[model samples]
Target: MILHFLGSRGCIDQRSSRHWRHSAMMITQGRERILVDCGEDWLDELDSLRPDAVILTHAHPDHTGGLERGAPCPVWATPGCWQSLDALPVAERRLLHPGQPTAVAALQLTPCPLAHSVRAPAVGLLLDEGAHRIFYSPDVAELSDPATTLRDVSLYIGDGASFDASLLRVENGNLCGHAPIPSQLDWCAAACVKRALFTHCGEEIVSGSHEEMNKRLENLGKERGIEAALAFDGLEVKF
Candidate 1:
């Protein structure tokens, strides 16, 4: 399977050439095209994208605002996500259960619950074809079951909200917000995942010097014995 990053910026006002658009990813295998998220930046570009289906991680505006006008094909999301999008004019809505693998053409997607937002709860996806496995979660605070979710994963695409400082907060006794890059790298190392790429970039990445940040990420990965880098718009990876 081939993965393409459509956007990399987080829900921040700051924008750079590398992280200009909101977070989104397009996965393709053979003739099947599946869009991961359709943020506001892609509201008017759906026709051009022409995806066979759209699978959402959550109902955050930065992730789902583009579907305000409705989608061209079937939309698959969790029950919580569908509830938040109930008022939208979606033509087809498919329910996705966490931990249950769903087949979309040649790929299998398993949604794993994540500790992110209380209002708009999110899930990280475990994408598996027969030969390759990838874990994608652009906005994440904590994973409920990292061992099970990350098992045999070859690549991990995680949040880039912060590089080292934790953005975690306790709201109504639940953890919310993004996890730092260092913490995510630890997860990758523990899971034995060799390659990792971070997206959903926050101010630290979008506003800071790219050269310094890249060096920091490289050094951090080396310490943990993993390969890591930052993801950018239009970046493509095959696995």
Candidate 2:
């Protein structure tokens, strides 16, 4: 599986005036594409790829901007996410309830409920193809033990949105409806995740730099005896 970050910031999409990079994420699940969140003006991101499906964990504007465009495709969302989209006229919101398994692009999808400000039933998706299982939860508030949720997986791509983001609110420069960095680390201790990636970053992160976040995570891991990785816009991983 290949995942490309089309937009990684939490609140808005901005271009690096100097570097000129975008903040959208594009995940190519074995050639077929699945867009995680469509925040900001991403006309190019949507029109460019013939996405097989669009998955929305919640209905935050930054997470569902593309739905406003009304792309002629199936939009898979939690019942809350569907409600969030129902506000839109063109969006044909389909149901993606937590704890239920479904199929998309030849991949089996299992959604796990998560905690967040919205309390709108955030989900952790477990994408499987026979033997490979990829557990993904991009935005969350706090994580419980692994037994009832993400316990074992080949890869865990979650709301590592930023190093210290979950602490602050979105309007106050936080990651909005998600957990703080330390909370996630505590949660990972129970899950045997081969690899962990951070996405849904904030604008401050762009200025602080991914390298700084990596160093912080490395230090945190060493201090706590665990490892985690920062999710970049163009990061790719193989299972």
Candidate 3:
């Protein structure tokens, strides 16, 4: 399985060479391609992308705004995401039941519910291709079940909204917003995940020096006993 990062910037005005566009990832296995999210940055570029299928993590504009003009292929999302995207012109809509693994483009995807936005609601995806497993959650306040969701996962791709300070806020008593990188590293360490990469970069990462941030991330990962780094646009990883 190969992972291609199309964009890494979060929903913010700050932009750098590495994190210029909105967060999105493309997973490819041979000729089959599955796009994880299509943000506003990719609105006019979908035709060229020509993905076999698109899997959305949530309905936030940064995650689903590209489908405003409709999609060329099937679009998959959780029930809650569908509710928020009902007005969109997406032709083929597929339902992703939480915790139920579904095969798309030869990859098994399991949607694990997450606490991020109260209005939009979100889920982290568990991607498996028999030999390797990866957990991807670009925006998350907390995972519903980190232990179960990350079990046997070799790589964890998570939110980079903040490095150490929590971005969470109490919204009607429910947590909302992205979790800090340090906390996510703690989760990875708890799950024994050895490799981790963070995308959906916030202002802290986008406006800071990449070299400095890389060193900080490496040091933070060392403290947690995990190897970690920041993911950049156009970066590709194979497993």
Candidate 4:
């Protein structure tokens, strides 16, 4: 599987040449092309990417607003996510169930509930092709089932709203906001996942100096016994 980070900026006004667009990613396996999240920033250029399908994580504008003008391909999301995207005239709308792996094209995707928005529920995806497995969650507070979701995961991609400080909040006993980077890295260590990449960048990463930020993540990865790296727009990795 080949993963591409099309956008990385979080919900912030801050922007830079390297990480200006909202969070989105493209997955490619042979001739199959799958896009994850289509933020408003990607609307104008989405067609050019030519994905076979679009998988949404949540209903947030930064994650689904790109389809406001209708999608060029099939759109897949959980029931909660469809509630927010029903107004769009997408060609095909598929409902994804948490824990039930859905085969699309040539890959398998299993959604896992995430603690992000109560009003607009979110899910992280476990993508697999035979023995290769990867977990992707651009905006997450907590995983509903870490034992199964993180099991045998080769790579973990996650939120990067804050580097070290806590940004999580409780809303009517529900968790919202992104977990700190250090805490996420700790999750990677516990999961026994040897590699991790962070996207959905916030000011701490977009506005701060790149060299300093990379060094911080590098040192953290070294201590955690995992390979950690910050994802930037247009960044691509093959697994």
lDDT by residue (tens digit), candidate 2, 97-215:
78889976655788877666453456777777556776777777665556346665656666655566445354433244667666666666566454566666655555666577678
**TM-score comparison, 1 vs 3, better candidate:** 3
Backbone collision tally, model 4: 0
After TM-score superposition, the amount by which residue 207's alpha carbon in candidate 1 deviates from its true location, in angstroms, is 0.9
Candidates ranked by lDDT? 3, 1, 4, 2
Better of 1 and 2 by lDDT: 1
User: Model 2: residues >4 Å from true position, as ranges?
Assistant: 12-24, 165-176
Runs of candidate 4 exceeding 4 Å displacement: none
CA lDDT of each prediction against the hidden true structure? 0.91, 0.63, 0.92, 0.87
Ranking by TM-score: 3, 1, 4, 2
Model 3 stretches astray by more than 4 angstroms: none
In candidate 2, position 66 carries an lDDT of: 62
Residue 119, model 4: Cα distance from true site in angstroms: 1.2
Q: TM-score of each candidate?
A: 0.97, 0.83, 0.98, 0.96
Q: Which ten residues in a row have the lowest lDDT in candidate 1?
A: 142-151
Summarize candidate 1's per-residue lDDT along 95-185 as a digit string, tens digits.
8998898986566889989999999989999998787789999999998667667889999999999987679999999999998998888
TM-score of model 1 relative to the true fold? 0.97
Per-residue lDDT of model 4, residues 1-239, tens digit only? 88999999998899998788999999998898999999889889888999999999999999988888888888899988888776877879988987788987677888888898887899998888677689999999887556567889988998988887688899999988888888788788878888889999998899998788978988998898989889999999987
> How well is each residue in 56-132 modelled by candidate 3, as lDDT tens digits?
99999999998899999999999999998878999899999988989876888889998999999899999887778
Best by TM-score: 3
